[model samples]
Target chain A: MQKRYCAIWFRYLLTDWLAIRKPELKDVPFVLAASEKNRIIIKAANQLAEKQGIIPGSTAADAKAVIPDLKVFDFIPGKAEKLLAAIGEWCIRYTPLIAVDAPDGLLLDISGCTHLWGGEKGYLQEILKRLKGKGYYVRGAIADTIGAAWAIARFGKEKAIIEPGGQTEALLKLPPAALRLDTAAVDRLHKLGFYTVQQFIGIKRSALRRRFGEQLLLRIDEALGTAAEHLQWIHPLHPYQERLPCLEPIQTATGIEIAIRNLLETLCNRLKSEGKGLRVAILRCYRVDGKLVGADIATGRPSCSVDHLFKLFALKIASIEPALGIELFTLEAPKVEDLMIDQEILWTPEGCGLESPQLAELLDKLANKIGAKNIQRYLPVESYWPERAYKPSLSLSETTTGKWRAGRPRPSLLLKKPERIEVTSLLPDNPPMLFIYKGEKHIIRKAEDAERIEPEWWLTQSPHRDYYLVEDEQGRRYWVFRSGHYDDADSQWYIHGFFA
Target chain B: MQASKASIIQQLQQKILSWQGFASPAAAETKRMGLGPLEDAFPNGVFPTGAIHEMLCPTREQGAATAGLLSGIVTALMKNGGVCLWISADRRLYPPALLSFNILPEQVIFIDVAREKDVLWAMEEALKCEGLAAVVAEVREVSFAQSRRLQLAVEDSKVTGFLLRTDLKKLTTTTCVARWQITHLPGALPDGLPGVGFPRWQVELLRVRNGNPGSWIFEWNNKGFVPVEEPLAETEQHLTRQVG
Candidate 1:
């Protein structure tokens, strides 16, 4: 029940990494070195290089002098840190609570996870076996405290899982460097003839603080579990998501639907109690073969009604392929909004169909079956240009404050972009007599007055447009615009839209 | 009880055809949506509400005319202030133009789905909702089975559905109240005025269940459609084929 931690010390991490890349180099004496102002310093050494008295942080020249045949490698920046973090992520299989100790080590909180793998012995064995099998030289130790585990892993003679309340005894034989003190303090301790932790274990706290500063006492107290130091474990992220792990993998549509309904019930209940509603819900099904298929739906208004949400999701339920079988399903409401309840009306306000909640749900279902962008309602804006005259509104209840653009006839459908048309006008300024669009010639049977729409000079340098409603021989009406003044050489004609 | 089994089936089918939608009417009488002389074209002198109608157009020009005609119809259906849902693979109906047809830009909801399957599915969903006045769908193809499904959905909720068939004319077997082909027609000049005429549509009734098929000229003046007297150049019995 006590908190337990595991420390994985990656000795000779850089050389081990190079050896993993090149198996032939493992038996050779090699050192990873960094260049500083034309001086090469050893950062890490392989086991063979370490035997020749080559010390890391020492000059590469001294390492080569100790062993002339020592292989040298450029120290890659952040490579060791990245490798340690990757190994820590892999350790999620062992314990979800794990953190990168940076550079060359990982710390794992194996308190509750150890029993899942049949106790600490089996858990430690599995971790060591897998990491070592990956071509890395690793030393691992477990203790009640992270500091104690870290010290025992890097400095202890035996790689043992120290029982709870045994951290002090376990750290006694280790060197003072195991306290993770600064180099200056370690040398000062050595000058004081306190090489082993056993020599400082019985020292007075105030006296130790006076001689070696408070850091030493803090380190010793942390290892002994008298002063707690929190390990920055990998914090797991759980959004407004509900996960359902099935007892047996479900392959049938009915089974999947049932699972989805169950998950939705719990999720919707949570949102409702929180006075919030989901604008979008994504249902992800994890297949037995490690594949994922999902279906998502969006609501115009925030909604928590189970039946309505179910119907919206039901529209696309057929699209989700169950595949071989689905083992887990996660329903997540990634976009949510506050559900502010509207004041109940004593009398129905004309029942314009927009105010009814049922209508909102119906529109949601329709949008899902089609798409969100496809369902649009517009409101008048205070602009003269056709594109700026109105704006697409998400909610039908949005009131229009601007005056509706005059009673002039606008095309039933507006083209996404105006298309160029070849035209011949009666005069230089008159409406076109004949026009060519899409290779089809349209003879204008009738023409209306040109409504001059001036461009916003502040917006662009384009000229004003003279828009005319013309009826072709086919009886189809079109809105055409001529850009720029008649005197301008670059004046162009375009068919903007159709009149229904 | 007095009718024979086969006769009963025939009568029941006739009743179903009279109803035209997915479900029977909540009210006893079938809704008559006919304006002017067009009422004579439908069964019981009424434009069938809560039913599915086909508006077929062969060309892109005619398709726009058909959209105009349907917008008028939808606006009429929602005169009591309701929403109209329009679903299409590529939506060409400009929201601003619906304003000229007396339908507010906000009253009409447009859904542009890239897939025909989703368009039909959305139509069915809209047709099942009791709040909507009508649903208009522009699609490339609608198999008899798909139309039947749409018909069934509209039947129960009594929501009207306008199947605006554009680009193709492949209506063989479908259970719609009426099949129509609308063409762009020259609007009549009011008292010989030199200006654009009111929006006119030459509507050809290809087939009508429990009613006689006929062709007529109509002019929409925003308020509603008014039957305009044609030149009377064609014979009454002569069947007119729909032009692309």
Candidate 2:
């Protein structure tokens, strides 16, 4: 079958929206104006204002003269594009592919989709009637090419639907301006007495290029179906999405679970065959009450196992509320990675370390139950600060070249931050003889020599810390640090960590 | 005739222990964790793998001591290149300190869950994984039922589990193979030195199923656990109380 395109034009896109919002603005002769170059120029004129010779692009002062009762409203930037995008999304129900034509039109690829609405004529009528009922004036035209459909939608006076393979004849009667050219090019064509496309349809290729430049020839070829035109859809097609449209609304958890199982089975089959695994998956339920509820699950590693993926999603099944029953269920894997075929070994050998598939699956379950950030793996780094000595590894397979510093006696449990302690020392720089922590006094029986650790100069200018391993009389060991030099009068003491 | 009768009685006792889930040393991986005489307090004269051991830590100091001691044992279990999972709520176990115990810090995965309930959940899940060497979880409390569930998971996977119970207020009986409490002891330097010596702890086996309960002083040097004789002359007699 031949490819066909349909273009829908909204003549008064913004004004129609304003009239629908404020019904009083329906019959008023209004024009939307915007300030440009210190002058308020009219950007769009309603039908009533248009009939009164208040054309757009004229100064607001001149438009006021044409109609003394004319109401001028500010032209909001990007309002037309927003309106077109909303309408295009709604048009997805008609055709799966819809692209915004910008300013005032939409292009839909209606090749295989027209048969769903009985034909191109019925399809065009259904869209135009629905949009018109929403208080907007819309015209739609269908042809073999996007350029031809676009031109006919905005300029064709007699027909709205051009027959298939008739774009050439349909484009012949339209004026040169309908080819969507720059204003300068249109003016040049008008000045050359080429009022309609038929006037230059038989021109020599080299002569046309030299006369009107390359754009005119390109536009003509696109209009006549000799060249292909590509369009960017509003919603990019999801390649890993599976949809289940239920004949009856699903109200029970069992039904929803069945839907999810079916979707995952199909999705996992595809992933396994393609040697790819899903890293993130989302399940969206479209309820009958016009509300969408979604649940998403992510994996620590790329996985395609049906049972494992199902378990992760099962933990999140309670969060999805199927209020009034769900009519549609869509499962989409938005992020995926290539899965090595050899990683699918069913029986993992003993002591596989981090490379074990069972370990990754266990972590994925825990992450989904709580969160991903709560689970972490650390690798040693060459730093003196206790906190900076290790960095969290992003993946299980990540390795580090730096070895952990084992020369010094680091505490088994390091506090998140050091706690202030009241101390009484015999001398200024000597270790505290007795310390009061949390209202309990501990007399120090033995104290190690102070190991002064200087702050990394490049990172911060904090004072050096003199750390001492002090064991209380009760045999509880604590790591305490004295800030700054003893001469700094403001030097304080704090308990930093615990030793086993 | 008397020797034959004694051998039959010993064989019957071994069968009864095996029926109670205490496998013979040859039947399971009999890798010594270098705990010296401490292993004698467990059934069959071996440290129980595929079983849960609960450690009571009433204070932060005890928690640190427990972590240090567990890391020493974990190093032996991970000799086959297996990884270990350390699940806790608000974990403060510094990874760099594990290096002193001869443990590759990267080989131990740390999970910091905000909820105490999830810590147990993660531990049970980690215990079920056969590839892991062991799972060490720190929770404020664990109900007997929760500990039983974790014990069941480890039994099938043959993975060791250590439960560091920080809050012993609700301490109750559980299905753990043994319960331990390790408290910090004042380090003793050689020849009256003026610095902190190697990590020394008074390891007490508070409860052990089907075995004797005892306490001893153990010190972690550069290599492994070494049983230390208490320096007090009067308590030196109790140092030999552990049965082999």
Candidate 3:
């Protein structure tokens, strides 16, 4: 058996081909003209205009002579890049090792995988046929070497691969530009009566190297598979992604649950084999009705057990409605970490029952039922004032322990807003003697002074307050305060906060 | 062995007093009854857990601070990883300000909503959550019909819920375990500093399930609240009354 190497080159049209084709300009002459106003250049040209001798890099006015009434559109670089990315993503169906040749092409390494489609020719036909059915015009070529395949895809008469050790004969009729040389080098070769790659091949190797430099000779060598060309494939940072395509659509909850269970089993097995566990899993069900329903669950720690994952999914299954039946199910573990594999000491005998994980799972279920934001965890804020010492968070995921402040005794219940009261007492150094609050008056009976908590000057510029607990003639107690510190001219007593 | 009738009656009274003060070993098994006193009552007793209680405030301003105090009581009870969910349609709770009462922000979850219906829905959901220690829902207007629904929901979940109504007059036909109206009270001043005294509020326990509804004046303290037992002492009675 002969060894075979295959390279699948994919191209993305950066232009809005659909918008251009909608005006019946698909078969009409059109040139994507670039402007010098901001140093932009024409990026692509339609086939009709290319046939009319109006090529890319030609000035807009010059192209107008070849084909008048040429429609012009403003060039948007960002949109073009996004469209290219979408195309690159779509090309993932062909090969996993897809490299973005940016702004317009993809390089795929489909070496051992081509046999799945009965060889490269059949695979190329299937891909082109599907893309054309989706209203796309594509040209593809495959070869033993990436350089030869790339050259043949762009300029060869037929979009077919050049067999192993046959690059010289296969590329003979092609122009020198097919060698993937720079524009200047190709023009230089053309000037030297070397229009065809065959002419270049006929020249003496040493003379070609001495006159045209080693770069040109190296291109020839690379095209003929004599030199090695390495390509880097883009790899996702996190990888436990599995996708299942069902031949029969599943709409019932039971059917979806079964499919989910199968996927979870496969995913957990993969995690165990890798000595890793997932912290977060996202299940995306692509419905045939064109709606995407996604359910995501996060665990406190990395876990690979099917039961654990199923419990989390159970909390969120009600949220996912499999409308119009789901045709594809994809489960991705975007976050994963190494599992803790240490054994507990026999002497200590760690509690092996369901404890923390069970509690966390219960909370997750409640959160899913009553919206995530409704379930909150409180984190203590480091503040001297009673009401300023804590904040509410969505979950216990945020561990901020060092922020807790000790020593001061805070009230169990603090009023949301302090109400103003009429107090009859001297200022600067005294607690209230008699105060009327909420339209009632009571004589002071007994009282105790709590320490004054001054606001942190660095954090906030709030005034100092003297907090005190007092009793009334009616034997009722209240938490009240006098705002401002001594000696400040602007210091005035304002009811700051109340304690329950 | 013959004795006078009066002397025999006196001996019988002494025996009854001893029996009432100290329970016999056999009587101890029969649990003392007669409905324990109110938890806040000085001589009454402490409030029992797993029981429903209520407090009502007549005015908005008076009720606001009292509500905070009630939250403090809830927080103190929730020492064992307990949580309180505050479902409200009217009041806007600022988390930082509530921390002074020693209520951990994590322990109290405030749900601020716009519609009255949503407030009831949130209250029902909070009550259903088993981990929560208690739920306080503030509805501007809760009808008797809606209150029945809430009562049933809370009963089913077996969680304590505090329903604070800004419009006290609107609570016409709902059956609550207790009702209270907190009113502002005059506070005593410290000796010789010449400034306004600390604020005070009178909590009126207007209704109770099996106890007497009476008002108690409590002085809010930094450490905790203390009931004003001697509001009318002889030494400063005239002076305090004049100030009031």
Tell me the TM-score of each prediction against the true structure: 0.62, 0.72, 0.53
Of 1 and 3, which scores higher on DockQ? Answer: 1
* Superior by DockQ: candidate 2 or candidate 3: 2
Better of 1 and 2 by TM-score: 2
Ranking by lDDT: 2, 1, 3
Where does candidate 1 stray beyond 4 Å? Answer: A1-243, A270-275, A282-297, A315-352, A366-370, A436-441, A472-474, B1-34, B190-192, B231-244
- Specify the poorest-scoring 10-residue window by lDDT in model 2 chain A: A340-349
Error of 1 at A349 (Å): 8.7
Per-prediction interface RMSD?
2.2, 1.4, 7.1
Report RMSD for candidate 2. Answer: 8.8
Indicate the worst ten consecutive residues by lDDT in candidate 3 chain A. A348-357
What CAPRI grade goes to candidate 1?
acceptable
Error of 3 at A87 (Å): 4.4
The stretch of ten residues in a row with the least summed lDDT in candidate 1 chain A is A347-356
Q: Best-fitting candidate, measured by DockQ?
A: 2
Candidate 2, clashing residue pairs? Answer: none
Lowest summed lDDT across 10 adjacent residues in model 3 chain B is found at: B28-37
lDDT of 3 by residue, A1-500 (tens): 34344433333263335444575766666656567775445556666666677666667777776668876655555665566456656767777776655555556677677778897778878876876666555667777777777777777786476666776787888998888788888888888888898887978999988877888888888888788877666553446998889998888888878888899999999999999988889999999899999798877567888986886787677778887889999999989999866465556322112123433554454444455665555677777766666666765546576455655433323456666777887655666778877678857666676568788888788877777766665544556777676567765444443333
When 2 and 3 are scored with TM-score, the better candidate is: 2
